[model samples]
Target: MPVAPAASLRSVRTLRGPGPLGAQVPGSGGAYWARLLPLLAALACVTRLPSFRWPLWSPDEGYLAVQARILAHGGELYETVVDRKPPLVPWLYEGSFALFGDSSLLPLKVLAVTAQLLTAVLLASLARRRWGDGAGRTAGVLYLLISIGLNPQDAQAATFEIFMLPCTAAAMWCADRRRWGAAGVAVACALLAKQTGGAVLLPVAWLLWRDGASRRCVARIAAGLCGPVLAAALLTTPSGFVFWTVTGSGAYASFTGSELHVLGRGLVNALVLAGACAGIVPPVVRVLRVARTGAPELWLWLASSAAAVLLGFHFFGHYYLQLMPPLALLGTAALQILPRERTARAIVATGCSCAVFLAWGFLAPRPDLAHAARLAEAVESRTGPKDKVLVWGIHPETYWLADRAPASRYLTAGLLTNYSGGRNGPQVGEKYAVGGTWPVFREELRRHPPTLVIDDSRGKPYGPDRVPSLRRILAEGYRPVLRVEGAVVYARVGRGGEGEGAVRGG
Candidate 1:
């Protein structure tokens, strides 16, 4: 047989074989991917393990876990939980809890880790199909590293967003191969995962429409859009499924431009978004340039993915995590196109390292778990077993720590306090009252009494004009029984009817 042309050999090697020119020559394709994929998976697992033991559960995670527990106990989804988010995430957690028995964070953590690995694998497959196996492996390895580096707390198993990256990758791959049906299924899975996934369909349809005026392309996009609705109806119960259709308008309406102290928090959020985008820019630009010439399909995917993320949701950092893997692959593609020089490669490597370090150091700290735990214990010790504990202007960690049923209407003042300069704390019987004042609190106490009230005094100061509601309660019939490090527990005196119970700490 005649030898292959030099250009053909180079193209084959760059796309499928080993390195750019003279890197390690692969003996076979299967063996190379088999070895590389596992190593990448292991690296991904190691980075996320630190989060498993850390007492850093966000409000979303805490709420989802509670909802999952309720579902496990045969309660309906939205009716019993009444959160603004969709039900798929809670259902996933419930399934995990059923299998693992809920003793450790292993189940939830594993779910995220597994999803990340699967995402990496799908990305590699997509790249290999387009550029060749070698390029695909490089893309896969880069994606694995980026996913670990940008480990958003929302990437945890308890949220629907974790499914976004994998579903997006699968959809792109199917579309690239002209397998419309498979692409539709992937898009449908994405939609059921989160509304942002639905936004991605627009970019996908644009890409498909560009390829041809074929009726097949239109059919595919329609199928993808309908997939989520059909799946929801078939998989979820009627009573528990209402959350799928709920628009969460109240949740969005509550975000009033992050005014007051919230402005400080908003500024911090802005900086984080800027840094994340900057870190991924070199790679994103590279991928866009390459796709403009070589692979239009990949270009469409990147464009659609970015449009889905930026235009779809309010700028939450975790919402951008799904976009990172594709950005990493784009970076690898950029590397392939650049002049092969040590200095250029060194600059790229340094930029990536700095970005990863900043993200981990500045963005990933576990906030206020210890303080919340201490407050929870103090409240649990002072309150009766049957007494309901209401946390106003407090972290949800208090509920997790105290093992008490949360009040129907929690004051999210704590979230606002961090952003504002004002100091505030929740007062006794405030949730039972209408305006959370003395007269309203008094009437609420007479109507539906709580045996004990826990006041969190650890936060910012409420100016002279805004007196703590608990102060008035102390003047009336409630007396401070115990004051812990950052929290105070008040007991109902002569008027009390309920008995206190033993406190247990997990």
Candidate 2:
């Protein structure tokens, strides 16, 4: 027989290392854990790396980027920019702007990736402390892979959750180890990062109590929870109050009593949650079955903590992303009970597959991109610097690309009519109605008239539902300039015998 080639042997050697297929390899040692970390991290970076240049910023991201630009230009951090998010996210974006100066999306996305990696590392360490190196490495690999696959919205650079997640994980780990002071500081930093950080506090408190800590210890934990608030106050008291009180309250309040538009969105979120629990539950059941009860209290604390956070709010899908790290650890610990390799492998494979789908969805092509880009280009080609642009029934992504000032209104009648709620206000004829019967929007538009109006046909008011408003605008002397894809741009036209000044487009 011919001798096997050296290159083929080298390929075999590489495959035996901790790559994706390495899980099938038989041996376990320090070398395995050592090789696993960088391999997982590299995989995490490679999967999400393409999203850095995708160029289609979501509405929230576009608005945050605009806010960041304002901050970089020495504008007031909070007051001048009126987004509902806490200041931390915008501050991060502003920092990116300062460093990269509109270079690419990498700076922003890299920040999130880095935070995710830290979360994975912390989770691994936490797993090792509670279980063993094998369990810890498994949890770490699971976290890195799942997080990449889940593609949490904050998976992007300016994500507040990404920053807050690691802090929360660290706090849980510290609390589990009875390191109260470190846990407190970590929780405090989490709170400073985002309001959702507050949800984990009660869970931490419960963990401390279960650890046989005295009532006095609980009080100290409460004080540590307060530390983040105090730190935030040191920066600016009123802003800090606004952060916790106004912004926090308003964000949650907005979610209640509103019918979600895309039914698919909620379904996808539920599937992801179910998938995460699937990874966690079998292991947990197996552990309980085996009755290996050392540190049962810790597992109970973590489960209760996760449940408390999940139950406390009506959060969107991304909100649940933070729960994955702790859940994965708890799941892996539970897996210790099952001596059967086949069952464990199946569970891990199922969880990993679900995660991959979630991550892929985040960077996938959205139908909104084409319409948004066309609207942006249309406005940019026509409008002067002195003119402003108002997008109705559309998100801020379009305006972000237009390089023109956006109107200050939160939502338009067009948006309300097209989206979740139907038109509830005064009719501007049949097709359009003001959302709250607020003529103030129309008055504001007339007072500082926009040079062009770009209406997205596929957006809202499908077919005859849009005609009345288009006609009313035409009656008021606006002429159609250009129509591209589903978008139509209208420019102001002079009335008969009227001076050129009568036309706003000029």
Candidate 3:
């Protein structure tokens, strides 16, 4: 790999102005705007183009959307609707739902696009502070390209990782500018966005200490980090916040496959990421070689992000989003030193790869919503708008599409069955649910009996027969009303069709 030359390194240092973060780079005037605006405009188009056609990008979106709807209607987080995720994302969705009405996902999609653009802009500014105007723009372009240069499910989704990136990038920029308190606030927001986002704090703290930040400065950052968290705790049930985000998160992370399985999955994820972002190879190599003194904090940031990506051993493509900002900065900076011809080739290659992803995102058949749509339709026809439904699997989409509330705080059966998407095979840890989730699930169902109990397990681990309480509930009051695409919809015997009860299907 062609590393950035020594001359380029010295040139960047000279361009760093006076202070680390507050340095005013040359050519950041009208000329910079002239070059940057077109690129940003292009970014806006590429980033949001796919989502315009398909509003609901992923199942996670459905989960958050439902949670936000619940929050909007006087429900509390964790107590009323639950997911083992931080509160910021649901709150963000609630704001969108409040503003645009939860019927359509256009508002949330727009927010996601704006976040991507803002994150790219922040990264560009950081690169400009570190390198120069050209490098900054290159970094921004690279970020926009690579972020969505994956399957639509991973890239276009308004996921936690997507929302987390801007805050993480903002923290990096603020820390570089010696704004400790602001950086800390950004860090807190990032952490609130996703657990992996806390990784950025390592690099930010390192930079502060390396720059000889005083005790008061450190105190300011600490306060910034704690204030939002305290506020969030007060807004929601603090105990629920700690349980879902921290305690439940611990168990969820630990529920992975064997060592061999994990290693295989990790290798595949790494290859997918590398192939998608192949243009950054030379830049990554350059950063590895020169980061010791030239950009130590960036190197640390990249390292920390990588560590975060490896968590849970399920390196889903979206997890790679955490790496893009830092990698974009380091890689674009490295490109500054390469020969003009080689640099053009790298950028062109990257553009070609990005174009492939964009084309697939737009041109490919819309995701297979047929089965889920059918299931939701079956549910909607039978249940009233105010009716509560329970799903016996990880199908949050059913709740969203049916436009019904959930009977239990456990939105998905994964919480009750210890079944993860890719981590485990057919085997579910029934014993794992012993740690209070099962009891809570049973109690929720008992208190607020669902009008419909839809078993979307499809012979998966958490089938109706697998859980004793679920089976008893079905036998005692619920009867199979309809079967849509392998999923059986069981309506309460006395609710939807009180007198038309039939024998439970085999």
| Residue lDDT tens for model 1, 53-166 | 554445566666656665776766544444445556667778887998743446777777777778778777766655555656666666655553434454432356675667
User: What lDDT score is found at residue 321 in candidate 1?
Assistant: 66
The reply for model 3, stretches above 4 Å from the true place, is 1-22, 28-31, 255-263, 286-293, 364-368, 496-506
Residues forming the 10-long window of minimal summed lDDT in candidate 1: 419-428
Question: Which pairs, if any, clash in model 3?
Answer: 21-177
TM-score for model 2?
A: 0.72
RMSD of 1: 7.8
Q: Compared with the true structure, what per-residue lDDT tens digits does model 3 show for residues 2-91?
A: 544776566356333335554668764677877786787678667668877775777788889889988999999978788778899999
Candidates ranked by lDDT? 3, 2, 1
Q: Cα miss at 335, model 3 (Å)?
A: 0.8
1 versus 3: better lDDT goes to = 3
List candidate 1 stretches off by more than 4 Å: 1-29, 150-158, 210-217, 230-246, 250-256, 259-280, 283-300, 303-314, 340-367, 383-388, 409-506
| lDDT accuracy of residue 354 in candidate 1 | 38
Per-prediction backbone clash count:
6, 3, 1
The all-Cα superposition gives candidate 3 an RMSD in Å to the true structure of: 2.9
Please give the RMSD to the true structure for each candidate, in Å: 7.8, 10.2, 2.9
Local error of candidate 1 at residue 211 (angstroms): 4.7
